[model samples]
Target: MKRFMLTWVLFILCAGTANLSLAQSTVYTPATDLTLVGKVLPTQQVYHRVDTADHPDMPPAVKRLLTNSAGLAVAFKTNSTTISAKWCTSPRTTLSNMTAIAYEGLDLYIKKDGRWQFAGVGRPNGDCTEYTLVRNMAEGEKECLLYLPLYDETTSLEIGVAAGATLQPLNDPFQKRILMYGSSILQGASASRPGMAYPARMSRAAGLNFLNLGLSGSAKMEKAVADMITTIPADAFVLDCVPNSSPDEIRERTAYLVNTIRQHHPKAPIIVIPSTVRENGAFDQEVGKRVQAQNEQIKQEVAKLQRSGVKDLYLLSYPRQLGEDHEGTVDGSHPNDLGFDRMLQQLQPQLLKILRKCDLAGR
Candidate 1:
């Protein structure tokens, strides 16, 4: 009886060892093998450009916003249906019930019948150092777009596929891009998942690349940030910072921001979006007045720019921009997925018009 018991224990231990070995055998391909979009470098130190010598050190605010890997994505093609990833994220936490995956998750999409479709998402396991994004993908070669994290800093990232599967760069033909600068909503606050962020959704819908320069509460139309913006070539520039600015600040700074961008991009369309109507504004008279005043000031400024020969300038109003229901937002201010979808619905038609006017489509 003792000998039989010992043999049973040995068999259990061997089985466990074999299972571990099999799991370890799965191999990963570095995401760098394909194309890392929206960044000059695969391992960029900061999401936005900074003059290190001028500042020498990153300001706490800049560091905080720049580290959030918003608007970055990896594009590739593979024959294997099963896709996976391993990534490390910087230490951070949020009060919102947003999952670690949405805050620090990897979102996957595939081009099907000439349209980008949602595939699957990988959830991080409690500040996990490494996590598998997806596995057992459908077999056959297909183009894929993988969106990076929305609110967390990605320290390292890699893509994995079943061994012996073909992985190559996705030769996307859409080259025209829209560069967006805004506040927390643009930074994807309270988004259920990374790809659900409006800009990502817009990119797939409009067939254009999007460069997100959302700075949380700090998108105050700073001149220094505009200076950085002058460097990237884009088809259109979307300024959506009304939520972070007061009426006075909008009046004082909006012209300079518009002029600065105009100096660099002489003909590219520039869309100035006023703050969206917040949910609480329906009941909070003070909040409603403040938002209305800011929107009016921005409209006046944009009109002035147009009269001053700022060609291709446009203004998107605030009223009913996110829908009248007021159910789109997660809080009174930040949007949930529903809010984002509503924003997208409103923005898409205007964006398509701008793209056509600029002759940026199919180029």
Candidate 2:
């Protein structure tokens, strides 16, 4: 009788193991059909260079946003409170003391015009939170749903929240996706907060979904990287890492990367964004002019490819209006909050044009 009981116990254990494996294999259901969902900025303490600034710094949040292999979630924190924040009509960021996490993903809610609805959500694998909603851009109340378990020690925490647009979940009748490749800036440098980053902002503005593959200080345009980019089913891809590459390197890699992506997404539009806010120009030499020139060359080559039957292609020049001289970045290389805004201001129009073209092309 004891032997029979042991055999039954083993069978039950095996069945449980099989069930767990099946559960793990389940793919995360994106709130939207598009892959390029907008990102939300997590809250943290402000880490300012100085104490006597116009802004009054706060302590870090009780619960912190985790940093993965990527060096994100590190740029905005003060001691505790996230320094990157948008000013409300009043002057208060929200407190983020509680935490939750769904094993698969998390959902966001917005109380706009006095109705609560699903705003947007993040993918479980990529470590991105703060989703962009599909609704119109107006004023509203936004809240995040934490999926992961919160630290028991964490208490009420403060977070910087942007008050411009509401985020809603995307539901797709058909599955389509977009991918973006770029540098640290794309990874989100000095954007007041994570959600405030231009890519995240642009994703919201454009109403398209995307996968952000931005690498901080690591956009080498290597063939291996290009090879990896070809493996995805992206409807569109943006190459904006040239600022970090040298002239010759940009010239050499542009065609290869374009061709590589083209091999997979033949009809998808590939937009090339030049470097923004660099070279420390005195408004004379246009120090960033070199990078700008490289972008132009890439644009021309893309044109040439189109003539050779490459389906959809586009170019976004660095607008002279948003030069580094105007805001003068804090590090002379990376843009501070002001510089980021200026860069975004320049990129926004160009981005709109390209996205509109994409929509027209039926992507």
Candidate 3:
């Protein structure tokens, strides 16, 4: 009788193990298998901003940052009731003002009713993490846009689906690639998630291809970097480097960057944006004065470009873009999600108007 009971218990334990294995089983599709948007150069299989090997002239800072997947996204469709992902991230330290999910996690969006809505997010557990993004819903075909990590390298990414669910590439839904180049704010620092970055937010809001070329502290408009950006054709360009550059650097490199770009893209619209008001500037007198100086210098530079027969060029700045309350930034340097949203609200419509005038956007 005792032997019989022991055999029964063993059988139950084996059954439970088998069930657990089946539950954990999922078929994953590599991100490369899906349509990729928000990329300026698709010259490599790896998800990098630019192929550093090709552009040996690129600044060391740019090359170091090229591997960080800032604005890359996978556009795909799946009929799975449960969606999951497995991604390997590069080694990086934790950001004090940024969430691990925002710096190195995946944000998923689903198209419903002709609009993109937040579906879910995959939180990182380690260097290689797998998390369920969305689950237990009505099973139907859904289009998905998965934004990659903003501040870390996505070494490899694959979208997981329950076995037998069909996954297919989604055609690019956005139009007119718009290149946004600037600092850490543009790189998505301090946002809650990858999709909250201003460029990513603007991309969804305007339904336009906004590629992020944010070089953190390196967007000094170096001639090498300028040459690299001009090599790629864009319908419009957003220069937001004032906050990262010194007054002298801006005076020296701003025109050279614009003129070189004009030589390549004579007709593409160039939109220059001044620095946002730093919250600390209110307390620190030098900070306030420097921001004011930068603001004046950018206006002067844009005016000079416009006067030099630089057609289709404009400087875009709004009163209190970060809100007058000074509650927008995460660290007084980088924008939090609210800071980004305020910046987007002011920049998008004005930008769309200019793009429409240039006939790059739908009127």
| Winning candidate number (lDDT) | 3
Candidate 2 stretches with Cα past 4 Å from truth are 1-176, 279-293, 296-300, 321-325, 360-363
Q: In candidate 1, which residue ranges exceed 4 Å CA deviation?
A: 1-22, 40-59
Give candidate 3 regions above 4 Å deviation: 1-24
How does each model score on lDDT?
Answer: 0.76, 0.47, 0.87
TM accuracy, model 2: 0.53
User: How well is each residue in 202-242 modelled by candidate 3, as lDDT tens digits?
Assistant: 88888899899988778888888888889887988999889
Q: What's the lDDT for residue 197 in model 2?
A: 45
lDDT of 2 by residue, 58-139 (tens): 1122011211111111111011111111111111222231112212223333334543334444332223322322234343
Residue pairs whose backbone atoms clash in candidate 1: 81-137, 81-138, 82-137
Q: What local lDDT does model 3 show for residue 136?
A: 90
RMSD to the hidden true structure, all candidates: 4.1, 18.0, 4.3
User: Weakest 10 consecutive residues, lDDT, candidate 1?
Assistant: 47-56
Using TM-score as the yardstick, the better of models 1 and 2 is 1
Q: Give TM per candidate.
A: 0.88, 0.53, 0.93
Q: How many Å off is the CA of 261 in candidate 1? A: 0.7
